[model samples]
Target chain A: MDFWSNFLINLVQGLTTTLQILVISIPLSIITGFILGFARVYGNKIIFYISTGISTTFRGLPLIVTLLILFFGLADLKIYLSPFWASILGFTLCGGSYISEYVKGAIQSIEQGQAEAARALGMNKLQEIIYIILPQTLIRALPGVSNEIIYMIQYSSLSFVIGVKEIFSVAKTFNSLYFRSIEIFTTVAFVYLLLIAIATLVFKIIENKLKIT
Target chain B: MISDTILNVVDLHKKYGDSIALDGVSFRVRKGETKVIIGPNGSGKTTLLKCLNLLVKPDKGRIWLGNIEITDPRININKIRRKIGFVFQDFNLFHHLTVLNNVMIGLVKVRKLKKHQAYKKAVDALSTVGLDNTLYHKYPAQLSGGQKQRVAIARALAMDPVIMLYDEPTSSLDPQFVNEVLQVIRKLAKNGVTSIIVTHQIDFALEIADEIIVMHKGRIIESGRPTELLSNPQNILTKKILIRNFRTLR
Candidate 1:
């Protein structure tokens, strides 16, 4: 009975930490991703090369390596960031790379004629992007972006490595304190599954409402 | 004479890599004239029209519309493009937007009209093309070939351009749907809008075009009023092509 109650408390704490990371990381990653994506698409050769390099570099490196490098490197700069912030930044960097490709591909998939038609209608470049291009790109990119969000949710478990008391970290703590590894780990796994299921349902509703394929 | 020249292309030359698409192509489209360009495949008819609209930049020569010379690299192409309308062989309507919104997009975003005013103009344009009743809320995919082409026409007309360019507009439509689009073009011509059309429909061109230009190998082989040129073939290419193909129409 005591083991069951302890497991419940740790699982709840883990769920709270997971939710907190998601709430901050997902939106920040999206905004940064979109901006970098547009830069990759329309920017000059130099800008395109630089952004592509950054995105590819982060995407190629392992997530734990990136997290360790950032945590240690930033500490060396004498600007010590919290474990939560470090993990957030690491995940965002990784997420931004994938998200940029999604956005770039979505923008490119739009018909060239659409832009031509917009130009023929007297829209300047900026107006053309905002009114015609962006709306269409957003609709087309929803599935890819949603997939990225789900990946981010799963990967937020990596926050445990940097000593951020995220779901897995809380689980680990409960196991060490109470020697209830199986119960705590199982509960944590179920909570993660529930979070993902809920998110998928919400996003699916939005996708259907928007009529995005 | 000066004001009659609505669009004038002088020695326009455009090359893609090593291949010359438009080699010294020149023409004058007077106000309210419906000119048809007919040619075998690989001629520069479509490229010529794209140059006039600044869609394809010319490698040499100049294009003049009214008093504005459009060859200056720093000049605003979008402003000049606004005055010209282009329709493609494939009806390039925004499939995502409703027919009404497709027409209204240019009016609201480019022309900066209020939403109410843009909607009114969109309705007026649709009505002009006789599609006001069937497609106010329908998407392009829901429309037939004829309806889709009409929506494309409505989209261009919503901008109220001074001259319209049609690049084989009816070439992609089914035989039954072709007449509906041609009829709309005839109506536009009758209303005194200058139009330059590239088409393979010899009979339809005979009925609607004031002047017919026969192009072969990137140059105009024969050009005159349709009655004069079709009645008397001057070049071997024109003779062979028209004699071989247009006997039924003739």
Candidate 2:
């Protein structure tokens, strides 16, 4: 009943931490995805297989499993990362693997003639990828990338399992102190709904504005 | 004095598994000459154009574009490739880019020209293909096949290639749309642009080619002026293919 007075500050703080994780993870995921996908398609056999193996390993594992391994396994190797950084690393690895598939698909979906024309024009391999291939890949991969972004928003809550004081973690505190399961979860549900709404709207605008000619 | 030789290929050989595509092919084209290659389907016509740009690597060959040995592993190929423009049958314009950017890409990216300079050259190339300013902003999907093909030609020509190679440029066009493309090639030939065109057009070949090279199975069966080849009938495959084509048109 007095939820705002008691829990509003922590809820907002949790949301801010969740967003911080997102900002760091999303860009990292995209760059990793592009590099992995490009390597898989065009790199020499060794690099291509390495990228393939890494992508497969990450994509095969569940996100929570990855988080646990990153968080705990690192300590065994005499490395340490805070729960925040661990979740960011885990989520990025997971997102990058999924996004890499999208990128590879986009690259492959493009007609081979496109690259041939670019090369025939005397553009080198790097120039071809930058001008002819990368632009089209971004456009083609938009829908897939945005879908991953949405998945990321929901999965950001998984950070709570790593002792991250993110959205669900804040909600858990409120649920326990208030002894009001229905109200606490309802508010949490609304927060998630609102996040999804904003994510969907932003991606829709981008996809419409930037769809391939 | 500039060497009259614009392109020279020496004993080019290529195969895909068991099938040989180009079998010991050799030829030379002079500056300002138009050489048309007439071949049946799957006779390595496209492969030959692709090989010229190193898109399809040959098993054995030496290709010289002027003094530059394109086949040499040491040379920077991108520099060599820029001087040799290639147009594909499918009009492989970048579908995501505007018709203008399609032309400007090589200029901006490969030539590293400033945007304004690239735009000016791109427009000039498009205008040469009879694509006016109005169509510059259009996408490939927005244009007719003829227009897309012209845009493709513009994209290639904007590079200012020393020699142009067309891979069955008109093969994908409708009967009604064929002349517009052929007409562009005709004008280019008349303007003394050195070019090698691979096509099924016997009529266009006779009209425009200074030398027509007929390929059969996988080798150059005959290479001569249209008048001489038609009059003398040297190779049976050349005679058969040309005669059949002429008969269909009439």
Candidate 3:
């Protein structure tokens, strides 16, 4: 009974940490993704080269390696970052790289006439992007972006590695204290499954509302 | 009488790698005149229309709209493009937007009209093409080919452009639907909007065009009143192609 109570408390703490990271990281990654995506598609030589390089580097590295480098190497430089911040930076970089490709592909799939038609209507380049290009791209990219969001939620359990008290971290602490690894780890996995199921349900609701086929 | 010179092209040239699409193409279109360009494949009629809108920049020579020279590469192209409407063979309406929104986009974004004002103009444009009631709320996929083409016209019309360009507008439509789109173009021509059409519909061109140009190998081989050119062919290539393709109508 004492072990059971400790498991519940640790589980709650882990859920809280997971929620906090998602709340901070999702919006930041989306904004960064959109900017980099647009730069890759329409920017001139310098911006295109820089954005491509950054996206490629992030995409190539393993998530574990990225987290280790940021947490350990940066700590030695006296640029100490909290585990929360380090996890967020690592997740955001990976999310941005994946989301940027989604955006770039969506933008490219639009018909060339859409842009020409906008220009013929007197829209300059910037106005064309805002009023015509971006709206259409967003709708087309929603499915791909939604998939990325799901991936982000699942992989966010990795935040526990750097000592953040995320869901998995709480499961680890509960197991060590109670010596009931099966019960605690099974509970942790079930919580993650529940989180993912909820995320998928919410996305389905949005898809219905938007009439996205 | 409408002015005799609304648009002029002189010695225009365009090349794509080894192939020359337009070589020394020149013509003058009067204000309110409906000019038709007829040619076999690869004769550069489509290329000329693309140049007028600066979609494909010309390599040499000049294009003039009244006294304004449009050939200067550094000019504000958006301003020039705004004055002309282009209807493509494939319709090219935004599939994601409703017919109303597609028409309203140009008005709101380019003309800087308020949302209400843009919507009003789009409604008016749709009504002109006789598609206002059924299509305003629907996406392009819901409409038939004829309805979609009319919406494309409405989208162009909402810009309130001075001239309109049609590149084989009826070519992509079903036989039954083709006349409906042609009727819309005929109505616009009667309303005195300057128009340049590149088409293979010889009978329709003959009925509507004020002047007709016959092109061969990137050159205007014959140009005159439609009746004059269609009745008597001066060039051997024009005579041969017309006899082969249009002898039944003649």
Candidate 4:
């Protein structure tokens, strides 16, 4: 096939698979991260320790190691997950930890006065966290969370390693058939750039809407 | 359950590290009466006001807000806090919320009022402090210092607390903005909200206080009617503050 025909065929397959994984993983990681972050800060001693331990452990381990362990090790226990599921599980484990750090930092940056004011108003602990602290925290966490999504766009390429046939894997197959390393890789870079640009624009609109200062 | 005292503090003591912030301080506020506390910067006046609502728990003391023992570990402090409104020095408005929401949050979250009911109360409270409907939607950052403080006052007032505590409510404002906040506070006291105010504004205290208490080194040195206390202060510290005030004003 000609270069244009080859590129177009690989692009469709690669981009679609990459987006499918990201579309589901991003929301799951964000929700999981928020709960973990809140638990790390507000939970009882046992819960706080457990949440902090999980985030710390995941953050320290390399993503590839986690994926290898999860994909292969699970089989020994009679649990079966496809390459796609393995990629998602690994990325979520890593992404959830990073997002939790962002959320925890955002919550900490809020002044002590906000909590005091909330309590003085007669809000119970749950109500204070839900109505007052969480709204402000999410607003503060937006820039960090946006950056995390951009990271997801880049890191989704890692899914190719597990034979998930994401964009990078498709690019690799296309390069093998055509023997065009420079051209194929350059196109992949631009595809990521395009995704980042779109992400940036979406985040900018959200940041403006949520800004308190 | 039926008590004329709006607040009572007995043998209140708090120490930070090696320093004593409040030492055996005691006072009582009757229903609908204003008690203005005056003192120098390190005099523990702020600590005393905070301990009333258990904002800063006293190391050793008993605080009674009506019939509930606020300092007791068994009591739900949140319920006690709602009945005793506190206006902070820095306004402490929720920066993320609009002025209306700032006033309404306590009503909705604490009082558990319906949104429309909370809305009406919020508007009434805001207008009570002279904030018009036009500024209701504006955020704290968009407001002037006086306006922000009024919103803070409105936030507390919307709860309809039986007692209000003011901790230098005008302390953070520009001189031009101070009078507006002071005026709103005076109106609350006049309209029969029991109050305990801590301020350096001696003239304003004399104008509004039903009783004036002078604090020095974590102790009440003099307590009496504003005129008598200011005119014939017995303690050297109170006399010094009074002399300084008169000299500056004259």
**Which candidate ranks first by DockQ, i.e. highest?**
2
Candidate 2, pairs of clashing residues = none
Which segments of model 3 are wrong by more than 4 Å? B1-3, B248-250
Candidate with more favorable, higher DockQ: 1 or 4: 4
DockQ of each: 0.58, 0.79, 0.61, 0.67
Tens digits of per-residue lDDT for model 4 on B121-230? 99999999999889998889999999999999999999999999999999999999999999999999999989999999988888899999999889898999978876
Global lDDT of each candidate: 0.84, 0.89, 0.86, 0.88
Candidate 4 docking: what grade? medium
Which parts of model 2 have CA positions greater than 4 angstroms off? none
**Least lDDT summed over 10 consecutive residues: which range in candidate 2 chain A?**
A1-10
Best by lDDT: 2
TM-score of chain A of each: 0.93, 0.96, 0.94, 0.95
Q: Which residue pairs come into collision in candidate 4?
A: none
Candidate 1 per-residue lDDT over residues A1-213, each given as its tens digit: 677776677667777877888899898888878878888998899999988998999899988888887787789988788888888888888898899999999999988988887777778889878877788877788888889999998899988888887788888887888887777778888877888898899889988877722
- Residue B66 displacement in candidate 1 (angstroms): 1.5
Ranking by lDDT: 2, 4, 3, 1
lDDT tens digits, residues A137-176, model 4?
A: 9998888988988988898998777788887998898888
Prediction-by-prediction clash tally:
0, 0, 0, 0
